[model samples]
Each structure stands twice: as C-alpha cells, then as structure tokens.
Target: MSTKLKSVPNDFDSIEVQPLSDIIGAEIRGVDLSKDLSPAALDAVHQVWLQHSVIVLRDQRLSDGDLVRFSKHFGVLDFGPNMAWQPEANRDHPEIFVISNVVENGNPIGFLGDTEVDWHTDLCHTDLPPKASTLYAMEIPTDGSGNTGYMNMYTLLDALPDDLRIRLDGLQLKHEDAHTLQGELRYGLNEGDLKTIEDAPGPVHPLIRTHPETGRKCLYLGRQWNGEHRATFVDGMSRAESDALLDEIWTVARKEDCAWYHEWQAGDFVMWDNRCVMHRRGPFPSEMRRIMHRTQIRDTAKPF
Candidate 1:
C-alpha cells in the first residue's frame, strides 16, 4: 500500500473513502460533485485517488460542465481527437467525449460502439499521454454487460519474474499511433501509407516508467495485439524478440487476480490514473444501450 494512503489525514469531514477491492479502486461517499467543494475535501479525494489508482463516486448527476469543472481540479483537460463518426457529437462541450452503443439518424452517436475494448492506456501513442481519465455513466444496459476492468500496474510489475523484471529495466517501447483501441485505423491516416511496423508513426516511451509524483516504477506496455501491424514493439530489439517478451508480460498482466471490474450504475463516476493502470471493457448486447461521458487529464511532462 502507498504510504500516503495509509497516512491519510483525518481532517476530512465531508466524505468517506472505502476500498472496493484489495487491488484497486475506492468508493468515495458523501459528496455531490455538481456543487463546489472545499479545498480540503478535494485534497482528500485527490490523495485517495493517487493511492487507490481508481476511484468511484456513485449516485450523483452532473452536466458536461460539471464533469469538466471537477476534472480541471486535477489537471489540464485533454479533448481527444474527434472520431470518424459523429464529429459534431461534442460540439457543446468538446472536452467531454462520448462513449456509447447508440445509433441515431443512421449514424453512431459516439465512439467504441458496444464491443469489448481491449486493455490499454489512453492515447499512449502520443508524445505525452493523458495523466488520467474520468468516465460518468449516463445509461447502462440492464442485462449486466459492459463492465469495465482495471489492472494495477504497480502490483503487476512486482509480480513479474525476478529475471524478467531486471531484464525489462531501462527498455523502451514504440507505440503505434495509427490504430484505435477498437482496431480501426485512426482518422486522416491511410492504411497504404505504412507498409511495415517500422514505418508506423508514433512516440517511443520507456517500457518501465516512474510515476512523476510518487516516483514508483511501473510497466508501461502501451498496447499489443496480433495482426499485420505490430501495435507496439520494444526499442533496440527485433520484432520477433519484442513479441516473445511481450507475450510473457501480457500473460502475467491478464491474470484474473490482478484486476477488478466495475459494474455500471446509471449515476456512477469513475476516475483512473492512466500512468499506472490499464483498463478494458466487456462487450454488451447489441440491442442494449450504454452511454458514457468521458474526460482526459493531460500530463504536464512526457513519459521519461
């Protein structure tokens, strides 16, 4: 456990923090985010968030502005690139991205339509990825689908084999920028423009990164998948070699013991640290509906 979490100041009077699981996530009770909060209250929430890696607040209604306001307290807001479909979906609050399976006027109203989103850190292909992401559930399928899972990277690194842990130190990974978590080519990128994984455009970041604030190291595998285009590869290593090592790393990461899944409630709001966590979602029934409002917090510095 983080020392900060263990020594949380007892000055908080407005909220109570309860651990959701031994691994990650804390449920915060007794605060309506729509209304302004005291500095101490926000500080308490922030501290718990850093220690927990993921935090949940339930049963509160918030507008786009309210969500953005609360998010700005943590860091500068990042408005993700517009999706190929429904480019105008967030015109009112560009910072608030929509995630949904709903279709309207023959066009999808949001991104990542009702499928199982693979594990990944948001925008890791960029030079500077977001520090964190916030999601608010507006509508969820009643059939018990679309639960989101989070993995604690700190624990994952500790769980690695001793030899593998030492071997991965000081290495870097090239994050491929052309593909989305859904496996679709991003907008304005031509598939024919790149022939090899080496030809892909994206930034390279340390395979093991130290959290800027906490200074704790964590494995930073941006993303991986089987296909023609290598989603990510290690620096100074052959594709085959990188693939072999990644296979081993991912095997440990996928262990059911290192993860926690959140079942959605209509008014649930979740915020997770993108630096030390990887998240994925389960597929929901196509006939059902799931709508979410999301915001990303920009990292002040590039990953070192």
Candidate 2:
C-alpha cells in the first residue's frame, strides 16, 4: 500500500521560513518590510509564528512606515506608553515603540547613565496585553553585545513534572502596575504620563494559560516580582508564602535550555508571542550604539 502526505506550501514570493532552532525561532528570508504583503504570504508567516513562538527576519530594511505596515498585518498595533525611551516616537506614531541607546544624530546614549530592563511580557500590567511584538534593529552594537534573550513558557510548562502541572491547573495570579523603576520617576514622568499607567488595574489569570490559537498550555507568570500576588489557598495565601511559591516555580522555569539568545544585527527583526514567552535585554557598552523600533500587537482573546 502507498501512503500520501501533505507538503508545506512554498508559494509566497515575499516570505520564507527557515528554522533557527528545533524548538523556538524561525528565520524568515526574502521579505522586504517596505512593501505590502499578499494575504497568502501574510497567512504563511502567521502560521509559522504560531508554530514556532518566535520568528526572526534578517535584512528587513525597514523604515518607520514599513514597520507599521508589516505589523498591521498581524493585528492592530498598540504602542507602549513612554516610560523607557523615545518619547517623541510615542507622540508621533502611536503604534511604534522605539528601543535605543543612541541619540537621533547617531551618538552613543551611554548605558552607564541609562537603566536596564527586566524580563516581562509587553503590556502585561494592562487588562489587555499584546499578542506579539516586533522589534527592528537599526544599528546594532559592534562588539557582538546587547543581545535579547527569550524564554519559552510553553517549554516551561512541558518541562514541569506531571504533579506540578496538576498543581498549577486552575490557579490564578494577580499582575499589577507597581513602579519598580526609580529612575523613571526621577526622569520626571508627569501626572498625566503616570496616570495612564496608574489607571491600569491589575488582572488575574490562570497560572497555566492555554493559547487560544494552538490550544497548548504555557506557564503564565508574567514577571515574578513583589506587589504582584497569587492566591495559594483559593481564598488566597499570605503574600510571603505566595511569593516563596513563585520563587520556587521561577527557579524551575529558568533552566538554560528553555531559553534562546539572539545577538542583534542591523536590519534584524524579531517577533514573538507575548502569551508563550518572556524576554529581557542584556547590557552593552556605554559608548556603543544600538537602536531598535518596535510594534506591539494587541491580544485578541483573554487568557483564561
């Protein structure tokens, strides 16, 4: 007897999927961000992103316009409120978030004077978080530094022993907008700027979130920090006991193989699902330059 198998489509002229790793990201080749993509091409890219959780397109050659256009294909883009960098871009393009350690005139912004960011999903403090985020690398550091690292929450869930998975089922945690950055307050975010974030009420979500698209469970601890609370006894445990539980879970979640590190290069674009991954940026030299433009896609569904 003969068996037939379906083949992956290779019809799109604009996009190509090349696997970067067996478990995480794919490198999409032959795509120019400047031009609009056909529905077929867009669908193809979306399918791969869902399957891989992260996708990197090299040599994208994006302008601000291109960044917005490419991002819109996925969903409505939501630019994060300014607390980090490029406040001007936040004002002009409501859909673009600029990530850079350089001045507009091509000068180093000096990392020593700036603050480092921690691992967290974009907009997780809000009731509605982003579905995915795309960052375009415009000028990368020369010394192979300033790489972004991503941890796969899906893998985190998979790695958990059966007993732990059963333990996390139906558990909920509170995510809040507590101010952790002292430097941000010192830099003078006005009442209006601060109010925008202050109004963001904390949300409660399952400890193990099931992806609406893929229907797979993922560990959903957005950022394991204080001020965020978890209910331990259904009636909820004391803050101290809950925090210790989270610390234990985080220790298990952060094993080295569950993460992938991407060294940035000029014209590299990285996009990942906020639902199934958490990311952080590494420090680079104070005198080196790096600029990145980001567009975030609003989450379409709630994490039950």
| Model 1 error, position 201 (Å) | 0.2
Q: List the residue pairs that clash in candidate 1.
A: none
lDDT of 2 by residue, 1-304 (tens): 1111122235443455677765577787766668776666677778878988998988877888888888888888875456444344536566767666766555543232223455666666567888999998888889987788888889878887787678777787766554432223323335355443223336766778889899998988776332233212121656566666676677776564678888888989899999998887767886787878888898888787
Q: RMSD of candidate 1 to the true fold?
A: 3.1
CA lDDT scores, all candidates in order: 0.86, 0.70
Q: Candidate 1's error at 286, in angstroms?
A: 0.9
Q: Which ten residues in a row have the lowest lDDT in candidate 2?
A: 226-235
For model 1, the stretches where C-alpha displacement exceeds 4 angstroms are 1-14, 80-90, 226-230
Off by over 4 Å in 2: 1-15, 80-92, 104-115, 180-201, 225-235
Report the lDDT tens digits of candidate 1 across residue range 163-216. Answer: 999999899999988887767887898989977566788999999999998899
Q: What TM-score against the true fold does each predicted structure earn?
A: 0.92, 0.81
Query: In terms of TM-score, how similar is model 1 to the real structure?
Result: 0.92
